[model samples]
Target: MIKSMDEFTLTINGKQIETKETIGVINPATEEIVGHAPVASKNDLDLAVKAARSAFPKWASRSFEERSELILQFANAISENQKELASLLTLEQGKPLSFAEREINMAVYWLKESANHRLSTEVLEESETTYIEKHYTPLGVVGAIVPWNFPVLLAMFKIPLALLSGNTLIVKPSPYTPLTTLKIGEIASTIFPDGVYNTLSGDDALGPMITGHPGIDKVSFTGSTATGKKIMESAAKNLKRVTLELGGNDAAIILPDVSIDEVIQPIFWGMFLNSGQVCINAKRIFVHHDIYDKFVDKLIEYAKTVRVGNGLEPASQLGPVQNLVQYKKVKNLIKEAKQNGLKFAFEGEAPRSGYFIPVTIVDNPPENARVVTEEAFGPIVPLLKYQSYEEVIERANRSQYGLGGSIWGKDIELAKSIADKLETGTVWINEIGALSPTIPFGGHKQSGYGIEGSVEGLKEYTNTKIIRINKR
Candidate 1:
């Protein structure tokens, strides 16, 4: 057990508030007590809101260049402290160290990219008498609720952009992965003025206080579809501006032209990265009927080589699921699928520990099976067969989730054609879960509304204002 002092607490109004009640942080790999963090009370949340509200005016009034410079500095600080941040992520969330490092790097990239995105001021010159120009202003006191999976990266997706757009933030990190966010707040204290950025860490109860609070001007949430619904309902009390990035049961379609061997590795990495805990991971695989069997056999062959163990182990390619709740959810889904007559195939002998679910593939799974329909959110892949391009597109769009999808084929035109038909916010041709800071990221339908990343993401935290002047 990795026990330490529970000195880490809420960062409200620019200072850490020491609390009497402590929440134990556990490492899933060994079920060890990694550390502890303070459980914030209602009063703590109030302080954070007041602080954000207080800082909003000065932050909103700053020039875009000034805000951009601070984001660049924060990015630099993140890169400089990469090791420490990555280690904390692994300790708290149990993803492989290398994966954690990659997430941190991505977070840095997001911060820098969001900061550098051009903020142009264009004047509309129409015959002098009636001239109108549009400019962006900050939304006051943004409330951000980030998930445990990819905690640092998700948090950066909101924090840097919100700050760059000149909004003060009252952030609530997932109770499971609050450590890194708390560390982020500590770093921001040195770079940002009081209340420009604040973090409150606690359980689900804290979410309502932050989202429902009248003081908060906007709310951004990333989590399950159910919770996202609740957040929307609560924010309605204030008619608060809200953006949600919820659940995704993304699909990947393989056409006859693509070689099985060529695409297997990329697909495996996409599905199993971060233990398949990603919102956009390939949860279902639809292969062309002609190549379906061969693809499945090759996928199993490659999955056997993967190593699963503690996150810190250099050779461990897959780590334990983030927490016991997710572990149980994955286990039950697999069991329920098997009960419904689906056959499970694995690359290696399943681990002795119940928490370490192997890289499992369900062959010829029924369309309605839990493995195929629900977001497994684990290293589980359900293989289904499709006869024609039309059938693949039809099945892919059948889900309520329109988060992400991928099409694989030798003909780029064919792939693009099918990609267009698949209902999703992001679609990759011959690839899966490929995301970059330059592109906007989000989902449609139940996957949640609104966008994140790129210049569009910065706008979510901003309000467009029209100012008119009269010429005498």
Candidate 2:
């Protein structure tokens, strides 16, 4: 049994409030209770919004350079404490320690990058006896909903950018991975004034409260498509601005010319990284007929070598699926696929415990299989073969979700050509899931809308104002 800690209370509007209801933070590897986080009630959400609203004017009035310098300090603090944060993340979230460390490093990168983003004066066209100018202003209190998969990194993407853009934030992290995010809030409170930034933890109920609150000017959410829709509906009541980064059933297309080994290596990383919990993971793979058999064999051979165990162990390449709910979902999906006549191949011995599902490959999986149609969000890859480029492109774009996809081949020109046909926000040619802070990330279709990261992300939290002057 996991020992319960005191409710993780946070201060909002310079007042501390503790909730009676607390959530158990579990370590999936051992099924032990790792920690406890407060389950914020509707009252807590109101306090958070009030804090953000109260702090907005002061934060927005500060010069960009001032905000930037403080954010840089926050970044430095994160770097100094990276190891501690990484360990906490692994304990609460169940990803490999290496992955956790990498996520912390990425968070630091985003902070520094966001701080460096230019937020100064811009010139508009001038004419005789007339002047015109454009300015960027903060969007008041922002409500951010982050996912558990990459808690710190994803939170930083919005927090620093929102702050630098002159907005105050009320951030609600996913219940599954609230530790790192709460730690971030702890660190920010030291430098940021009270109410400038606040962290809230709870179930889905808090989300609607935050997004629908009159005090919140905007909502930035990263999670499932269904939840994103719910957020949109709630935000519409108050007309709160929204930016959503939702579900993805990304595709990986292997063209005829590429050597299977070269392409498979990167695909393996995309499909299996963080135990395939990533939104942009290449869950569906389409290979040209000529290399289908060869690719499948090589993929299984390489997968068999993957090491799975407790994430804290250095030798473990894959960690347990984050929670029991996700574990059961993946297991049932695999069983259903098998019942539907899909062939399953595993690289190594499956774990005796129900939590550890091996790197599983299903060959010639039909489009109707849950593994192909839904976001498996686990270490399972369904392989399909296509005779020509046209047929494959059609199959790839048939899904309702279109967040991201990739094409792998030696002929860069051919791959690029095929990449254009796929209806995703971002397409990787010859690689998969290679995201950078400089690139804009989001989705199309049912995958959800609006962009995150890059210049677009900074713009998401700002209101553009135009000033016009006429002199006679």
Candidate 3:
């Protein structure tokens, strides 16, 4: 058992392996050391890969029903410890307690539903003279590297699917927010077989090691586009399978027919969830000139009501940026906008002590401005005005990153048409970030590739083989 959740250790081969070196986990709210996480080296990562490689065959041999049962147990275990995990998530990742709780709940839901899926051979052809079939088989061991933004949930996106598809795994949680994931690893140590599911925590060194490790058959990663490119390049060395869910400058286009009242709340939450750190959050907004000013006014009004503070507090609606690096990066974006003379629509106040940034909205920033083109990954968002549907659609699809986007309007047909034209992998009609376990989620262009949910996603953890026979 783990000695303490705060001082978390690495889980390798179903054992809590304490490291000689450790890193301090800071609370973004107060910038205080909440705990220490084991800093894994190349050797530690190698050991994890070796363990997973050895366990893959046996784990893969298990029946789908048996695997599903164990996955369900793991999900239930997470549910039982939901509160503790949620609090830990909030403390480490700096999202509010409420959002943290929701993340845990959604993670559990994903795990349970993922286990319910199955893979079977497809009968391609059958005749007196010939027979052919296509089978989906496990891809030895998966190295799942999860990000700080929605760490637990993103890890869940990898875990259940990889395991259920008969792949052993070594999870590398972001060093910035490794506590809750390590705690989950502790729970996993009890449920999974030795070497079947393992987790290691470390800084920059671990990622390259995981991607380049020959023993790791596949790598599933979720993070920035720039990092995703590097991971793809590294994985290519051994030609290991890779699934990347990268950065997204997702946009939400509000048509002239949209009800200002109807969309205000959804757009507000979409832009500011987790203080707008979401990969697919509405980073850019394209509003019709007919309702652009009104939309901005209502959105600013709603932004004022959100309370920003320490995530653990009962009343804090949004919390600080997850780490010092990201905090500085976001602050720089805000500063650049100010330097560029962008019009400010709304700027909420924040406490002085933490890695906090106010809810900053830039009004009608130029298409060429950084605030309009870049993925802020913070509370700062740009509301761009457009004169025509053609112009707005063109502007919305302008970015290099396209993970998800949404079209908001009263006319369902109009919204559907706009959503169809979106360059994103997932486009919501009259909604934002409405993700379901059964639906496949991925990205187009620089946002990264490979499906993350549904049977399509589950298959990414496996390899396809063809079987053919001849009858005499």
Candidate 4:
């Protein structure tokens, strides 16, 4: 019996709320119905938003110190339930048990750190008789749309930051992975004021409701580019501020001088971590011709050694793709790549059942090929060969999506110079997609608008009010 979630009930206004209809939560590894969560109705969404608007005054009126204390309290609550949270995340998210634990720890760290991260006041002018103060103040209710890939971490990314900035939030977690987020709502219910932190679990309607709702002062979303554009359109109806972290076809370039042994693990993890479902995972690897064949050979050999299976199994190094839709997407892309004459560097096998796909390396697919251009967001990655560093630099920057990219070489200065030329939001010299709460993370170009992480993200939850004063 799945008993963790009060049998998958919704949390709203600090209560276990449910609707007549319910949704089944699935475990991707076993293809089993893990539990059932309430399907929120349109009425439920309205009530939640109304409650958030009602709670906004109290939450936003609190001093920064008071807000930080509440945030710390919420962080403590999560820390106290770390084991339970991590276990539930592993079951719903399809990440290995250990990875889930690390994610949980990361969430805890971000939450605690965000509590103490104070936004600095911007002083435009100050004198003995006159002073100008410019700073951010709270938005009413932030609608946070979370993706399934890293539900908890992403939710934590928005929730603590939003709350610390004195804004209440209404979270709509991806239907594919709502149980863990629903549980997070339950945890918040114990710490936040009623309606301060609410979660609505449903299918299609939930997103539109939150984005289009007049009560939502801003929207912080993480998902695909298509959906992000749609969200922007919806939020435009009310001119709600939006911060979107959308799709990424991140490129990782390997220079001629790097040793295969040193770059192998970081490169593999950059491409394959979270089974390549990561938004900033190095989806395309461009290698210099000097070591193209040599790197492919070593990468394939390393790819074979990665274990894939059920997340609960400690031995499992990589987990399933998380859902059927993504599974079919990966499979179709691989099939297309195979037909396009793209050859695999490593051929790892997976069981017929479940959503598991082994790490697949496609060697030298043309830049225009589907597998090369599109974001597979799976274990399959394409390695392209480049003749010159300048050519690879141009190719890496030639993408609609530019969330992140990397340059790997023994000479840190040379790699940094190369990375400086990439058009992504973040570039790593010897790493790919290394994130920190202290630094901001966002994308360039069509990857979407606005930023997350750091004080810049906290400011996203607020509107700046400028006041100028002079003695008469």
Candidate 5:
């Protein structure tokens, strides 16, 4: 088991390279420096890029069968080290230890599933005299910029797809959660060829350099829309292929027909899972007027059961925000909501120490309130009342983000019909947010571009080539 405070270094060409400068990674639950991760220098990045460039040809030449075995081997390594990996993850990212375990298991599952997905050469046209074949080829070096929330799983979302599709990659873990992310490269090095996968942990500058680097052929990022735009602008200089999974203010609508008891747990967890830190978390909820009061009452009644505290505690259902910046953001929003005279259906108070914030739920506030319009990215979620399906759908689509949304009702057909109109990447009917390796997931608008977790996702890492042959 790898301990939390153990020293970490950048991985380049299968080696752990020491750096002159290092950044202290903190345990957000305690706001204490858990350990320092080595920051890669400009020269270090050059060496990493050169290594990937050198390895791409040989690595990409391997057949899908060979690559799939390698990915499964990687999954085996993860299973062997899961206990230590989960501990390190919970220590850094502030989710419960159980959640960290689930994340690790899900990552391994994703690797196995992703390995099973591969493309076959398509016959575009064939005749007695002529034939044309369409197939995908690797795009060389890929730079993956991962966010702090669900660091391990999100990395799995991209890493396997990138590698299995024959592209070499450098994964840049967020400075806030670098421990588990860097360790992936360490485990991967034992089986993967040198530089086929590398991990770099550093401050903000590191991301820009990777996006702007000429040798990096593709960039897959999961973060905020603001940063995604900056990544687009930077990547434009090199014309690098970029696929971004960004911020979301996903809306969940409740219809009058649903049984409150049956749906309450899914909805509650949907809203507050990982303390509401998920990109696809149901951030804004719109309930029909017929059931608004009853639904809110039931929601508050259920929410009273959640206990927020340090993630290491066995019963800690909710953990602290992953960093001070996000903690303060949630704090300020709560202050603003109170000052604006918004009524609270559920009353609660946050703890004083660490990055802890209560599981806050803001009642329907004015539409212009920051809590209503912005991505809280924390425990606070706003509940809005709606009069009609058309109005609710319109309101849900009013956000700048279109990452994911959900509609709930007893009538599955009706709920699915309503879900079809939502302007988001993935929509759930009578359900909330659920991801599968077979599902193609991404955003519709400002949620960023491109797809992940499907054949389309794998295709993003490769370019299509057509070959024509004629009988003489």
Candidate 6:
């Protein structure tokens, strides 16, 4: 069992590896140093990759049942220490305690659910003249780069899929919130064999090293589209398989048929959950002109009830932005929107200190405004008015991002029809930010490619091979 510590080390080849330099992890709520994390060098990354490469053959040779059982054990281990990890996660990631615990619980659930999936061999043809079958074979050494937001859950999902498909892995969590994940690595060290699962923590340099390393056969990354593009370019040098889950400026359309009383709370949370740091959070909203004013008023009423404070406090409903860089970016976007003469529908308050950005609502900002056009990974949401369903669909589809969008209305068929026309990877009618481990989730267009869940996601860690038998 790993205890909570102010100083954390890297796990490579089932051993704790210390680096020459160390970085400080910050608590977003108080702007205080939460912990110190060892920073890995290029050589350290190489050693981790080498370890994973060496462990691949033996790990891959294990039976599917054995791997599944091990994964379930891993999930149980996570559940056992859920409280401790959730506390540490809130310190670094700045989400409320409830959301942090939810993330941990979801991580355990995803691991167990993923364990239930199997990569069975498929029979393509059976006849007297010929027989054909397709098999899923493990790709050696996968490098999984997890983002700061939802680090544990994101990394947990990748673990079972990659390992169950028989690939050894190296996880590189974002430098901003690597503590809980590194702690997870500590737990993994005790269960899995040396080199089968490893974690390396460092500054920005480690990511390129993982993606470019020759020993690594695949890269599974979740982050910004800009960073995802760089990863793709780096992985291309070795022609390694890459799964990139990048940025999203998700939109939600509210039709006039919705009950203002019933839908306000769900829609408010949809936009403000995780303080709008989620990649699939509702950033842009389109409300029908008939009910736009009432919706906005009710949404403001619901927003006022939220209490933003330290995650450790029991009363805090929202926490600070995860890191300094993202905090500034979100603040700048809000300033830019105001400078452009956009009306503020409702701008809530925040404390004088810490990386806190109040939940702000922009009223009918133009299509090209920064708040509506770019991805605001914070609590700033822009609400736009649409006179017709076709107009809303056209506006929603115009953006370069096509990660996710939602339609809220009483007419299920009407909402479904509008959902079909929106250009996005996922669409929810009267629902937002709902993800299931059994469902496939990915993006389209500039948001990036590759699936992250379901059978399709499991196959991302493997290569397909066909076997054909001929009779003369």
Candidate lDDT values, in order? 0.84, 0.83, 0.91, 0.87, 0.90, 0.90
Candidate 1 overall Cα lDDT vs. reference? 0.84
- How far in Å is the alpha carbon of 96 misplaced in model 2? 1.0
How much lDDT does candidate 4 score? 0.87
Worst 10-residue lDDT window, candidate 5: 1-10
TM-score for candidate 5, please give it.
0.98
Q: Is candidate 1 or candidate 3 better by TM-score?
A: 3
TM-scores of all candidate predictions against the true structure:
0.96, 0.96, 0.99, 0.97, 0.98, 0.99
Clashes of 2: 2
lDDT of 4 at 145: 94
Q: Report per-prediction Cα RMSD to one decimal.
A: 2.3, 2.6, 1.0, 1.7, 1.3, 0.9
What's the distance in Å from true for residue 287, model 1? 0.6
Off by over 4 Å in 5: 1-5
Model 2, position 469, has a per-residue lDDT of 85
| lDDT comparing candidate 5 with the true structure | 0.90
Residue 397 CA displacement from its true place in model 4, Å: 1.2
Superposition error at 330 for model 5 (Å): 1.5
Stretches of candidate 1 off by over 4 Å are 1-6, 347-351, 470-472
Per-residue lDDT tens digits for candidate 4, residues 1-472, read: 1236446677778787868998777888989887777888878988888888899899888888998998888778778777877888888878999999888888888898878778767899888888898989988889899999999888878888899998888888899889878887887888889989999999878898888888788999999999999999998887999999999999998989998888898899999999999999999999999898899888877888889989999889999999999999999998887887787777687766789999888879888989888999999998999998789988998889989998888888888888889898999888777788889999999997998989888888888999999954
How many angstroms is residue 111 displaced in model 5 relative to the true structure, after the best TM-score fit? 0.5
Which tens-of-lDDT digit does each residue in 79-137 have in candidate 3? 99998999999999999899999999999999999999999989999999889999999
lDDT of 2 by residue, 218-336 (tens): 99999889999998998899788999989999989988888877767778888899888999999899988998889988888788788888889898888888889889999898888
In model 4, the worst 10-residue window by lDDT is: 1-10
- Cα deviation of 162, candidate 3, in Å: 0.4
Would you list the clashing residue pairs of candidate 1?
none
Look at candidate 6 and tell me the lDDT of residue 124: 97
